[model samples]
Target: MTRSTGVVVIGGGQSGLAAGYHLRRSGIEHVILDAQTAPGGAWQHTWESLRLFSPAAYSSLPGRFMPAQDGQVYPDAAHAVSYLADYEKRYELPVQRGVRVSAVRRDGGHLRVETDSGDWRARAVISATGTWTRPFLPAVPGRRDFRGRQLHTVQYVSPAEFVGRRVIVVGGGNSGAQIAADLAHAGTDLTWVTQRPPRYLPDDIDGRALFDAATARRKALDAGSTDTGGVAHLGDIVAVPPVRAARDAGLLHAKPMFTRLTPTGAEWADGTTVEVDAVMWCTGFRPALAHLAALRLRGARGHIATVGTRAVDEPRLHLLGYGDWTGPASATLIGVGRPARDAAREIAGLLGS
Candidate 1:
């Protein structure tokens, strides 16, 4: 039996929850299908000590404000997960967890979504799975032969696991910098290897303001306008404070890009070698669009093409939390809500509500 809904949301994370909330507010019937056992998407699987670099004020969803003390740093991953759970309950969003969507295709004039549990037919669908679906580990030679435990930053939970081991963290992004600092303080012998030294940002700019200038610049770029020569033209895309702290703490090393992994350790492009007990790859993630193979995606760099936020080919298909449409803010908690609300309004109009 095919379970039918007015609209089917593909993810139950912040974006999906926001979409569901907006749809419900408009009195539209919809159901959210998520692969996880509960809400909070990737937050549920993030490292134990991870915290938002943005303040609580910037981390809110559509209708709720993040509960936090004044001047306090952003919520950690656990706190974020708890907040998302509460958001779901408060809005009474219709979500079906543990239903991994395997495929999505257009059936006649409607959308057909096939999942592990069953099939759902709906008038529209929103892909809010976020950008971190697949961890992108570079194809370094000899990685299979590495004897030490090599893991992605996604699998890292606590520094205690590497307390007595020599750990090498690869990458210069926020994750790499933060993990290096944590492990170094945890008494683990650590080395942070990065090809490009990151441009760090101050934890608090003037008057304790979180640095959101990057997001604004990205939005301008996406809108086909060049950045004005101002504060935005100051530095690299990665923030500066964490990187500076990591370097000051003796955790960062400007190494060549990873060339390969040997049974003993890793080799860099510059032929330098580092022997260690573990390797933590903090490399970024790629969009998981394998399930959308049936949809003819027309975009550069393997992304689905959109004309001003709506899919060019699929009318009812819209992308949320994608940096392509709304800019870098699309990926952050603070940035996703407004676009999600806009998408919900568009979806409601399409449903003739």
Candidate 2:
């Protein structure tokens, strides 16, 4: 028999959990379906030493605060996973683990969500899968010819795995920089390849004061002002400035643009080459919404078109955790809760709750 619910959340990560928490508080019945066996999505897959650059005060779910004192650094990947597990148990959120949602289609008035277990029907659906559903590797020449074990950062777990090997970390994003620095300290010969110059910011820039400044600048820019470009260009919000410090220490080498991958290593656009034993692609991630083939997507990007905050074409569907609405804040743990709450309120109104 097909199961039915008032709402079905597609992911069980921070955003999804927050959505579920809010919905439950508002007396909305829903079930969360996650592809992973556990609650934390990308966090469970992150490297061992990864910690939230945002303090614990900002990196928290809806009801419960992160278990840390004031001004304490947020937990690492494992600690985050444990905290999420505890949150699930504490709230008694109904989550179907290991049930990979393969397809979602509109069936009459309700939506049909097909997973490995069975099909589910829901009156409303919130796609909280976030932006990291799929690792996006750049289409470079000779990628297949690379005989080294090339893996995306999502599959990376620890630098100890690359102890004595020559490792090449690709991309200049937070993940690439952090991985390069971690492996460098682990006695691994490391090289970081990026197409653009790296940008950095201090670890605790004025102690959460930067957030208010950034938010204000972001608002002013939204109101059509160009005076905030300097603050806006201060690198990604999730980025930790210490990565550049590692580069200054001569532990990381930022190379030119990527050209091709070879059996021995990688070749750059400047005719330079590095013979590395392993390659970790920290390029970034993209939304994995291919299963929603029935929905009218905004072309190949798979993003739903929106006017203001409401979805233009599909009013019943909603997108949370997208950077477009909330800026860089939407994608971070600190930024997801507000959007999730807004989405829940919108969904509730649609359901006549």
Candidate 3:
């Protein structure tokens, strides 16, 4: 069965919710298709020990603020999940849970979204599927031969599992620093392997600074200027209390990425080897656009060709929360709001015209 709507939002995560907020304001008839049985998108799956690098205020949706509970400086994963779940209910967003979208194809003038349960037909489609399920691991020599357990950042839960075990955490992003800190605090042996030293913001600042800087950059770019400078490199590690404490204890140092993985551990480029029981890959993620493969809009970089969130090849389509490629900081909770809002406006305009 196919139901018609003004727009069909793919993924009911932060970005999808943000889009829904604006689309509802515009009185656009839209349906949000989510694969998860629950409301919190990726937040529900994050590890127990995981907390936002910033405070609750810095990480929030569009209309409502994530209230700080128990004066917790940074909200934990459960806190975030609860907030997201409540936000959906409070907004009365039209979300269909456990509806896995298998593919989306252009049917002449409209788009048809194929799902496990049913199909969705809409005048416009906004693909908000984030990168949580598509964790990326770099190809290394002898990676398949490594016998030690290899896990992505998504599979990681807590430091308790690594206690008394030597583990190598790879990646220079916030996840690598945060996870390594968690394990080190628990007395677990950890080796931080990164392509370069991880950069950290001042202990005083958090994601707010990055958000402001990105806003400024977007304004500047829109005004046809290239000079967008304030807080540079927003994706760098934020010196949250835990990470700061880890740095003070001299546990945040990083080694150059190893050349290859051995059965027992990893081998460095300079003839050095480190034996580890597990390799935690905190590398990164690619775009979760597999369902859109049938549309043939993806480019060589595994990203859809988007003309500022709108698919360049498909006029009735837009993608949100992919990464900087879609918009500056589009993957962040607060950051996705602007892109989502703009996408909604564009979709409304197209459906009206």
Candidate 4:
């Protein structure tokens, strides 16, 4: 049976939840289809020690604040998972877990949302499948031939797996820096690699500052002023306590990108080879938009042409939480709400019309 809905939201992650929050408030008939069997979305898949650099109060969705537990100021992955689950219950959101959306196509005036379980015809569709499931591994020469283990950030769980082993952590983003620190603390011999110089936010600043700076930069750009007064880039590392400790121990340093991979490990441009047991590729992720390939909305670099969060080529669709390109820092816990709420309001208006 093709169920008819006002809006069909894909992915029940933070972004999707935020969309649902606004949709419910707007009295729109919507259902969120999540691929995961549980409520936590990608947070449940994050590494054991992963945490939000912001305080609990700042890391909230649209309507509810993320409550701190046991005097914990900054929430961890588990807290985020539980909070999201509770948020859904609190809002009475219509989220259907374990229903992986297969594709979204035009059904006359509505969208035919094809999934494994059933089909939904929605007036508008919100794609909020975050980057966690689509970790990117840079194609280095000889990487395929490397005999040692090569794992992407998606596969990374804990540093205990690399204990007593030589490991190379690639990329200078938050994931690479955090993984490097965790592995070092676990007694793993590690080398850090980055495409360029690593940028770090000041110790006092956190995700809140990052969001504020990004918002200012976005506003300036909109006003034809790209001069964003030395604000920290969103990708820059936040000095969380553990990361600070690693910086103090001199383990937070990164070298230039290696040239290629060897059977044992990686080779540098100068022919210096480091034999390592594993390579942790923290390069980052692309949006999980494979299902939407049929829409033909994506442009170069696999990004869809978006005006705000709405896809330009397909006006009925909105892509949320991919990154700043979709909406300023929309992939973060606090950031997702902005784009999601905007998209929800837009969807509601569209459905009403």
| Candidate with best lDDT | 3
Q: Which lDDT values do the candidates have, in the order given? A: 0.76, 0.75, 0.87, 0.86
Model 1 pairs whose backbones collide: 200-239, 200-240, 200-241, 201-239, 201-240, 201-241
Residues 1-353, candidate 2, lDDT per residue (tens digit)?
Answer: 69999999888887788888888987888999988886777788777777676666667777787787444355577777877888888999998889888888888999898889999999888777876768888888988898889999888888878988998888876788888888877779888878777665655552254455556665776788865653446664344544545666777767776688888988876788889888899988886666666776565655667642346666666666655453326566666666678777888898994
Clashing residue pair totals per candidate (backbone < 3 A): 6, 0, 0, 0
Model 1 lDDT at residue 241:
46
Residues 189-297 of candidate 3: C-alpha lDDT, one tens digit per residue: 8899898777788777787888788777877877889867645654478877777899999987799999999999999879999899999999998888899989998
Tell me the tens digit of each residue's lDDT in model 4 across 63-178: 89899867566678999999999998999889898898889988898889999998999888999998888888877998988998989988989987787899999988788888
Better of 2 and 3 by TM-score: 3
- Higher-scoring candidate on TM-score, 1 or 2: 1
TM-score of each: 0.89, 0.88, 0.96, 0.96
lDDT of 4: 0.86
- Model 3: which ten-residue window has the lowest total lDDT? 227-236
Which runs of model 2 end up more than 4 angstroms from their true locations? 69-72, 206-232, 237-245, 307-310, 325-328
Q: Where does candidate 4 clash, by residue pair? A: none
| Model 1 lDDT, full chain set | 0.76
